[model samples]
Target: MFLKRITLLRENIPSMKKYPFYIPSIQNLEEIDINNKVTFFVGENGSGKSTLLEAIADKCGFNTAGGGRNNFYDVHAAESSLGNYIRLSWLPKVTNGFFLRAESFYHFASHIDTVGAAHAYGGRSLHEQSHGESFLSLFLNRFKGKAIYLLDEPEAALSPARQLTFLKIIHDLASEGDAQFIIATHSPILLGYPNADILSFDDGQISKIDYEMTDHYQITKYFLQQREKFLDELLNDE
Candidate 1:
């Protein structure tokens, strides 16, 4: 229960909020509860899923770009101002955790090399491995239970098989180790994490929805079932 809930202070902004605020979904958001042990943020691009994850990471004392608090290599400060206005209720003590942004993982890996902490991640340089391999290595070697993890599109480099493996890692951490996860993703496979919270950020709002109701599931299901039919329509370029 280290990171319990989050609420937005819409009126507390001293000046105009920028990138995230400009996005319609985030603009109107007021509050979102993180009561569930595993919470997932699902939405289309620019729908505020990644933005919210970054803000949460910032508020939790992790790098807005990604990695744990100790890993700080702020290249350009590209994160938005949404973090300052976010209010989180937490338990007095939070177990150690990590914030992993797939996009900036390369930079974090470089920092690991600079600090000579490769042993903690996998006993080798992350750069030495392929993209997906590095990610799996990080989670497998690190990530003990009872910590809060924030991941933004972590499936970016993983294949379908790896996504399933990642999902198992998440489940093990939560069920076996008491770890909590907050993730933003587009993968239907990851979204099907056995009763995890699915918050949809579309149509200028964020609301909890059932697993089967998600567009990701429906569309993926439809496409898989009717790929040939869809190819007939999708490739019907007239």
Candidate 2:
């Protein structure tokens, strides 16, 4: 694993009293250990999960939109200064890394096409394929492993079946023993990665949780087991 730990330095707390720093989970943040090959960040929107992921990726010098350092495309404004207050510990060697923010991936893909790098992703342009197809193709062809991958809600573009494929692909990457993943997602299937360190950001608190305890898993199980009951409850007018 490239990243060993992440610490939110206390000295930075005073500076978080304003706009960008208003994200509560980041305000109360502590440290997170990167002991496992796969670390999943799960949370509700506005819970600060994406913010933390963005901070980490930005701090580590990965492009804020997506792709490695050399793959530049200026689409987004500068990220929050939160990355400035965070500290990361790493192993001696971190060969390569990529930062992928799901919402911005389309822009990233457009940049790839603009740069005439279709060959990098298996001779097909990302825009030419279905979102899920392109997502899988990216890992299958471009993820040469021995690297760190930071992904934010990659499941946004994946079907359940495709999520499983992504899981398997990531599992295979982890099996190589040199790649590490820090992903923010709401997919139960992705969070089910065995032995992964799952951090939950619910109610503005970041805490470690088991797969079964995740809202994604719990709500999915409830909905599947009693679909009609849930439907009735959800559909019935008060």
Candidate 3:
């Protein structure tokens, strides 16, 4: 199962003119391949990474609730004008997958008992666990084989050490060919998966980039280089 291409067609989008509706246009759309076990989307805030993932999931008929066939009203509200293109495309469809939004897992966990139990080791809720432990548990226990998992900002709750743990889990998933992941994240560690395609969305377009060339990698390098100076400045300011 692979995603050959995804496209966006015209639809009514928000407008500030006389009418509140305007047609959204997507030209020279980005083409992403699921050839690799992991594909990452990296971009600044509001660059449409989440929108793209939702659109792809919508195109594939995955429930927005992150599980089996159960739709919510918000799913309708989340619909994109790009649905027209998704409707007309010939992408290999997906079934049995989870779209884990790191921020929303707290709410999501409340709904599933097994997930709740996993998060709550020995009757302790995920809240009782350190943020990193909770995140690792979610990644390790929830992701099974051969499913397309979509993750957004997974590193938000993880420390550098936990990020390494995530990398190991991802590597194991790939080796087993039981999972294909599309992750939108900022952690350099998560983006460091060998041979994974890194697509950068910037200035209204998406382009393939090398891992070493990523902003996350460069930013992390810069900080590590000037850690003492940064720490001094912060301490002095306080």
Lowest lDDT block of 10, candidate 1: 13-22
lDDT per residue for candidate 2 within 1-238, as digits (tens), equals: 6799889986856766774567778777788878888999998888888888888888778888788877877875646567888898988557488888888889889999999999999899999999888888888887866888899988888999999989988988999746899999988999999999999888777889999999999999999999999999999959
Worst 10 contiguous positions by lDDT, candidate 3: 16-25
Query: With candidate 2 superimposed using the best TM-score fit, by how many Å does residue 129's alpha carbon deviate from the native?
Result: 0.7
What would the per-residue lDDT of candidate 3 be over residues 1-238, giving only the tens digit for each residue? 4454554432433332321112111233435545566899988876767667766666656555443334332332444444434442334555767676665566555545544454333444666667777677667776777677778788988888878888988888867856778899988898988889988876556778899998899978978999988678878985
Best by lDDT: 1
lDDT of 1 by residue, 1-238 (tens): 5787789898886654566687877888888877788999998888989888888888888877778767767757647578888988887557478888888898888888898989988788999999999999999987896788999999999999999999999988999998889999999999999979899998889899899999999999989999999788889967
Q: Give residue 43's error in model 2 in angstroms.
A: 1.0
Q: Rate the local accuracy (lDDT) of all candidates.
A: 0.86, 0.85, 0.66
Clashes of each: 0, 0, 3
Residue 166 of model 3, lDDT score: 86
TM-score of each: 0.95, 0.95, 0.76
Candidate 2: segments with Cα more than 4 A from true spot: 93-95
